[model samples]
Target: MPAPRIKICGVTQAATLHACIAARADYVGFNFCPPSPRFLSLPAARDLGAQANGRITRVGLFVDADPATIAEAVEAAGLDAIQLHGSEAPQTVAALKARHGLPVWKVISVSGAADLAPAARYAQAADLVLLDAKTPKGALAGGLGLKFDWTLLAAWRPSGPWGLAGGLNPANVAEAVRVTGAPLVDTASGVETAPGVKDMDLIAAFCQAARS
Candidate 1:
């Protein structure tokens, strides 16, 4: 099996963005959800996204945001894609993809096998489906550092492209790959020194571990 492509989400600093690039992470995510500690301003996202443009795929993370809001952020940041970490329905995901003409990665918050029931619906509209751990009631969308049972993915079969997220760090990532066969692996809180603070060493270690 191929080593999974890596995404370091919730990147807020230029240095962190550069570190993600230097570490050869495939995707660099910027948060636009207002409630998130990792939230990035459109202007800031613009700058950081530009800094990462050619070397990495810049993904803007949103949570049930309006079309105008997503459009404005895409224009400002020149985002290659947008990740929806909200309660958006299937039609809504399709509408956004049609309006923006950009790939939409819908986050599936999984606590069990039943939670994955929405995958087929979402796959029809979303360009990719990212399976992450379910969060608490009324909590912020992502970077919660919670993990679901990896065995639940033993036969996960999304209609289209898929990836894994939540509670993944260097030490456990190789094993995560071994069990899940996820072609893409995403991490946020796992490499953080604090809420919204990413550690350079952890970022490097995570990329290396995922590839091993």
Candidate 2:
């Protein structure tokens, strides 16, 4: 099988962006949610995105942000795609894709087989679907560093392209691929030394392991 595409999310610094690129990451993500420690200001994200120019895809990550917020980030950050990591509906995904003329990746939190049903709802609107671990009630979306059962995806399929994420580290990435056959894989806290702080060595290891 072809190697799975790797997307390193929650990148907040230029150094981290460079590390991801050096690791040959297929996509580098920037958090736009202000509450996140990995959040980047428009200018900061713009600078880092410029550094990634053409070497890898630049993705802007957002929660349930308003359209204006997304528009500003896209303009300022030069994003190639937008990842909606919130409780957005299918219509919202379609609207964002149409408004920005960019690919939209919708994140679905899954803890059981039933959670997989939502993928079909989003597939009609989103260009890609990201299956991530469900966060605890009343918690923010994503970057929780929690993992769900990979076995739940053993026979899983989606209406569109899809990816696997949440708590995926270098140590288990190969096994993740072996089990789920996910075409893409995304990570954030898994490569971090602390919450929102990415470690270069871990980043490199994850990319290498996933590629191998």
Give TM per candidate: 0.98, 0.98
Global Cα RMSD, each model: 0.9, 0.9
Alpha-carbon shift of residue 203 in model 2 (angstroms): 0.6
- Which window of ten consecutive residues has the lowest lDDT sum in model 1? 153-162
| Cα lDDT of model 2 by residue, 57-135, tens digit | 9999999999999999998889999999998899999999989999999999998999999899987799999999999
Given candidate 1, what's the lDDT at residue 158? 68
lDDT of 1 by residue, 1-212 (tens): 99899999999999999899999999999899988889999889889878887999989999989889999899888999999999899898888888888899999999999999888888789999999999999898779899899999877776999999999999899999999998999999999989999999999999999999
The global C-alpha lDDT for each of the candidates, from Candidate 1 onward, is 0.92, 0.92
